[model samples]
Target: MKNSQLYKGSLNTIILKLLEEKGRMYGYEITQKVKEITNGELAITEGALYPALHKLEAEGFLEAEVEKVDNRLRKYYKLTENGQLETANRLSELEEFIRNMQTLVHPKWSY
Candidate 1:
């Protein structure tokens, strides 16, 4: 699936999980990682990714550090203490949402 519609609800959780797994990542790296992980089923565009990153940073859920990588000054994002907690909370919420969706979609199937 192109997964365009699914981005809104899951993007934050996805970003947090990636950061949780891989310490720090830059914008392009984050987009690549998401594509790699999902086998290209989901693609986060630069336009979408940067704004989300900025929003998270503004919310104090993410912290960005600037460093010179190769010939470019790349901004790497990592989670703060609040962000770590928020990640866990967001993941839980996502799991609950999945379960709820499964229930609604498949009424006969119970997990």
Candidate 2:
């Protein structure tokens, strides 16, 4: 990410939203998807990605399944029931945050 701090707080939400859309994804796929979606403005690093994935899995928001693809094992993540609900909630909160930031950054004038 060009301004990782700006996006850091929303990483979990971002992951949730992606999994919700893609159904399931492995770690590297998630990283590449984010980069592709953002036209490379955002690059999710393994250092940042795995801990968040582990945290979400521990929190019951995600579940992982490992599969052998070719000769390597790939762990994929998908949203749990709770995760689906949480995605809606988090998306609402993120949208509101963006709207609030927009208001602050580009306020309308009242005469």
Candidate 3:
């Protein structure tokens, strides 16, 4: 799960889903949550994470707010209205993709 190539394409969708579920989260918090959820199998690196966040923010699918925590500013990301709809759409798409991959990988079971 820590394989970047395998999970890179899904990062945005993952972030969206997480935001939808958790309301809002900072970058570090997001990485920790994902690691915890995956039982340390998956680790999100800051290298991939920040770019995805900036892209989401630029696309208006997410909104960021800065708050002072521990005497330092932290940027927390949340899904916007469009992001909510997009998250639902992306989730559906991912579900279909998963089914398709499963079918291809286990053709006998797909029958």
Candidate 4:
């Protein structure tokens, strides 16, 4: 993202959520999808994206399959059983965070 620090903490959750929605996606596909979803406001760099993907894979939250598509090999990631469960938890946490931030940023006026 343009403001990386603000969004860095949520990267993993974002990835998991996207994978949950897309079923399976390659790294570049994930990056492009996020760009498309956010209308280019957020851009995930390879430096950031790969590590998150690797970490998720190591945590058993994702599974990767390598296949030769057309001419080049592509790695596709799909959510595992644990990932499915984690996605729910991550989304819930993210929703709560957003609500909290909203309250803090725009508190209701009381007389």
Candidate 5:
């Protein structure tokens, strides 16, 4: 689904979940991971990603650390305690959303 507009609210949830699974990741890594998982259907742009990461950090949902890789300083993000809690909530919400969508799209199909 190219150009399948992602809801802005779910952005944080997606980032938090990814960080929870992968431990720590840099900006590029985060974008790549999402793209990989979605099979190139959903692409997270740097513009959207950086602001979300910063917002999460500001909200105490994440922590950042800097590391040197190949003579470049890369900032890595990891979930905080609050982030863990947020991840659980977000995942549940995402699941519910998917279930509701399935019900709407396949009203006569029983699974």
Candidate 6:
């Protein structure tokens, strides 16, 4: 498993990107999907996940819906209109950062 610091900075971006791709997702579903996609190399703890989610919701970048499923409430999150735009912007920023990091750290590779 990677260190928390390595994943910490990207948590919000990761969540935004996932929501952008998946439309809407519940918390556990998000955690599982991330683990699946990363082949279990990374995991999102409730400690980290909930705060990021709550912050995004508070910042108007996400909206939530609550539904009763199997005698419990499940809160699902989706991007707002502002969030859709922010997704585009954040994605671009992330991509650009990746490119820059590659240039610095993997300069021998040919893209």
TM-score on alpha carbons, each prediction: 0.93, 0.96, 0.94, 0.95, 0.88, 0.92
The Cα error of candidate 3 at residue 52, in Å, is 0.3
Over the stretch 1-111, how does candidate 4's per-residue lDDT look in tens digits?
A: 475788999999999999999999999999999999999999999999999999999999999999999999999999999999999999999999999999999999899
What digit string (tens of lDDT, one per residue) describes model 3 on residues 1-111?
Answer: 476687988999999999999999999999999999999988999999999999999999999999999999999999999999999999999999999999899887534
- Model 1 residue runs over 4 Å out of place are 109-111
If the candidates were sorted by their TM-score against the true structure, best first, what order would they fall in? 2, 4, 3, 1, 6, 5
lDDT by residue (1-111, candidate 1, tens digit) is 766686767888888899989988999999999889889988888888888899999999999999998998999999999999999999999989999989899899558
Off by over 4 Å in 2: none
Question: How good is model 3 by TM-score?
Answer: 0.94
Weakest ten-residue segment in model 6 by summed lDDT: 1-10
Instruction: Identify the superior model by TM-score, candidate 2 or candidate 4.
Output: 2
| Per-residue lDDT over 1-111 for candidate 5, one digit per residue giving the tens place of the 0 to 100 score | 544565566888889998999999899998888889889988888899999999999999999999999999999999999899989988999999999989898898658
Name the best candidate (by TM-score). 2
User: How well is each residue in 4-33 modelled by candidate 2, as lDDT tens digits?
Assistant: 699999999999999999999999999999
How does model 4 fare in lDDT?
A: 0.96
Give the winner by TM-score: 3 or 5.
3
Candidate 2, position 63, lDDT: 100
lDDT of 6 by residue, 11-90 (tens): 99999999999999999999999999999888998888999999999999999999999999999999999999988998
